[model samples]
Target: MRIFSTILDTVTQRLMSEPVRHDPAALSRIRRAMIDLMPKDANWEDERLRHRLLVAVDPTSLWFLRVELHQRLGRSVGEEVALESVQALWPLFEDSIEPALLGKRPGRRSNNQRGDTPPGR
Candidate 1:
C-alpha cells in the first residue's frame, strides 16, 4: 500500500505540474470540488483545512486526497470526473461521509451495526 501510495503521489505531482494547473478556471473548479466533497462536521475540520491548504501549497496532494475520497465513497474516477456538478457526487457519498469525517475507513461498518443479519443467519 505504501508503494502504491508513493507511486500515486509521484504521478499526481507530475500531473499537477502541468500548465493547466495555473488556469484560474481549473483552480476554481478544484476548490469548489474540495469544498463540496468535504463533510460538514467539526471532526473533519483539521482534515478539511489541510486539504484546502494543500490546494494552494501542494495541489498534487490535494488531487490525491480527492481521489482517495472518491474511492472510499465507492465512486469510480470516471464517474466522479464526468459529473456535471459536484453536488451530484455528494448524495452518492452520503453513506460513507460520516465515517470518513470521523477518521474511520468507510465501508468498515459491520453488517451487525447496520442492523443486517449475519452471513450464516
Candidate 2:
C-alpha cells in the first residue's frame, strides 16, 4: 500500500511541475466526486487543498486531475470516457491521494473540524 502511494505521489508531483488552463466547472465536479468517493473520516481538508493547489499552483498535475474529474463527470452525465483517456489517474487516487489519512486520529475531529478551539489559539 505504501509503495503504491509513493508511486502515485511521485507521479502527482511530477505532473504538477507544467501550464494548465482547465475549466472551473470541471474542477467543481471533481471536487464533488472526490467528496463522494472519499471516506468521511478521510483528511478532506488537507487532500482537498492539495488537489486544488495541484490545479491552481502546479501546472504539471493539472491535466491528470482534470481528466480524472472529467471521467467522473462523464459518469454523472452517462457518458463514457475511453480507457486511454486517463488510465493512470485512478490508481493514484486509490493509493497516493490521501497518504496522511489512515483513519481518524484521536482529537482530529475535535481539534480540526469541530467548533472547539485549540489551547494555543
Candidate 3:
C-alpha cells in the first residue's frame, strides 16, 4: 500500500508540472461559457459552494467569473452568495470541474479538439 501511495503521489506531481500551450479559441469559449452559465444554473444561488469554487480557482479566473456572475445577478447577489452558497453547491460543481476545464481546451487530448473559432467578422 505504501509503495502504491508513493507511485500515485509521483504521478500526481508529474501531471501538475506539465505545461499547456496557449489556446485562444478555448480561452474565449471558456470565458463566454463562464458568462453564459452565471444566470442559467439555479444552484449558483447557494453561498457556500460559490466560495469554494472561488477559492479553488485562479484569482484572474475568479475575478472574471465573479464579474460574469455579478453582471447577471447584480452586486447584492454576488457579494452575498459566496458567504454561504459555495459550501452547498461545492460538490455539484467541484466534482466535474477538472474534466470541464480540461475538456474546454483545444489540445489534441481535449474532448473536442477540432472545434474552431468562427471566421473573423
Candidate 4:
C-alpha cells in the first residue's frame, strides 16, 4: 500500500507540473460550454453570477479559457492577462473575481493614482 501511495503521488506531481495543450476542437467545446452556461439578461451585479462561475465551470474549462485567451491575444500567459481574459470573456464576473483573486483590478488606474497631469489636461 505504501509503494502504491508513493507511485500515485509521483504521478500526480508530474501531471500537475506538465503544461496542458488544448486543441482547437477542445477550445471550441469549452467556449460553447461557457456560453451555454452563461445566464442571459440576468442581473450581473448580483453575487449569484460569481457563485455560479465558481461552482458551475470546471477547473479544466477555466484553464483552457485562460490559455485560449493568452494565445489569441498573442500575449505571454502572465498573471495579469490570465485573469483579465476571464473577466473579459464573462463580464458578469468582472469586478467580482478580480478583487477576490488578485486583490484589485488589473490595468485600471484611478484619477488620483495617475500622475499629476494638470486639471483637465
Candidate 5:
C-alpha cells in the first residue's frame, strides 16, 4: 500500500506539472462566452474583468478569473444559475487545463463551510 501511494503521488505530480497547449480559437470562444455572461449594466468591475479576459494570453489567467466570473454571475443572476453557467464553461478548459484543476469550481464553499446559506436560499 505504501508503494502504491508513492506511485499515485508521482503520477499526480507529473500530471500537475505537465504544460498544456491551448488552441487560439478555443481561448477566443471562452472569452466570448464569459463576456456574454456579463450583466447588461456592467460596472467598472465588469469592464475590468472583461478587459482581463480579452487580454489574457494563457489558460492560467483565465482559470484564475473563473472565481471572479462566478461571483459576478452569482450577484447578477443567482447561485444556481452561476454554477450551471460556470460548469458549462468547464468543457472549454478541458483541453487547456489539468483535469484535477477543473474537477471543482473555485472559491465555492458549502453552507456548512460558510455557515450561511446562499442568497435566496
Candidate 6:
C-alpha cells in the first residue's frame, strides 16, 4: 500500500510539473481582449504595449503586460472600470499562472493600512 501511494504521488507530481502549453488562438484572444480596452486615440505608450502584445510568444509575457494594461485603463477609463477589466483577465490566465498569485489585486489596501493616509492629515 505504501509503494502504491508513493507511485501515485510521483505520477501526480510529474503531471503537475509539466509546463502548461498555451494555444496560439487563445493567446490571440487574450491579446485582442486587452487591445480592446485601449482608448480610440492611443498614445505612444499604448502603441508600444500593442506591439508587445502582438509579438509576445508566451503566457508570462501576457501576464506581466496586465500591469501596463491596468495602468493605461485606469488613467483612460477610471479605476473602477480598469479594475474590473483587468480582474476579468485573471480567469483567462488560470492555466498559465499560479492560482495563489491571481487572488491578490495590486494596490488594494484597507483604509488603515500604511501609506494609505493622506499627507497633512
For this target, which candidate reaches the highest TM-score against the unseen true structure? 5
- Residue ranges of candidate 6 with Cα displaced over 4 Å: 1-20, 100-121
Clashing pairs in 2: 15-60, 15-61, 16-60, 16-61, 18-59, 18-60
Model 1 alpha-carbon miss at residue 22, Å: 1.4
Q: How well does candidate 5 match the true structure in TM-score terms? A: 0.65
For each candidate in turn, the TM-score is 0.32, 0.25, 0.24, 0.24, 0.65, 0.63
**How accurate locally, in lDDT, is each candidate?**
0.47, 0.44, 0.43, 0.44, 0.76, 0.75
C-alpha displacement of 71 in model 6, angstroms?
Answer: 0.4
Judged by TM-score relative to the true structure, which candidate is superior, 1 or 6?
6
Mind giving the per-residue lDDT tens digits that candidate 1 earns over 44-94? 544656465345533444443554454433343355453323334333333
Q: Report the Cα lDDT for residue 96, model 1.
A: 30
Writing each residue's lDDT as its tens digit, candidate 4 over 1-121 gives: 9999999999999988975443545444545544443434445432353344344344344533443344433333455544454445443323223242332347655443322122232
**Higher TM-score: candidate 1 or 5?**
5
Query: Tens digit of lDDT per residue, candidate 2, span 1-121?
Result: 9999999999999989874454555544444544454333435454664456444532234434544544454554434432323332343333223323323255555335321111222
List runs of model 4 lying over 4 Å from the truth. Answer: 1-18, 45-121
Model 4 TM-score (2 dp)? 0.24
lDDT of 6: 0.75
lDDT of 3 by residue, 1-121 (tens): 9999999999999989966443444444444444434444555453443554334334235433543454445543664453333223223333233534423343444233421211120
| TM-score of decoy 6 | 0.63
Weakest lDDT window of 10 consecutive positions for candidate 4: 112-121
Between prediction 2 and prediction 5, which has the larger TM-score?
5
Would you give me the overall lDDT of model 4? 0.44
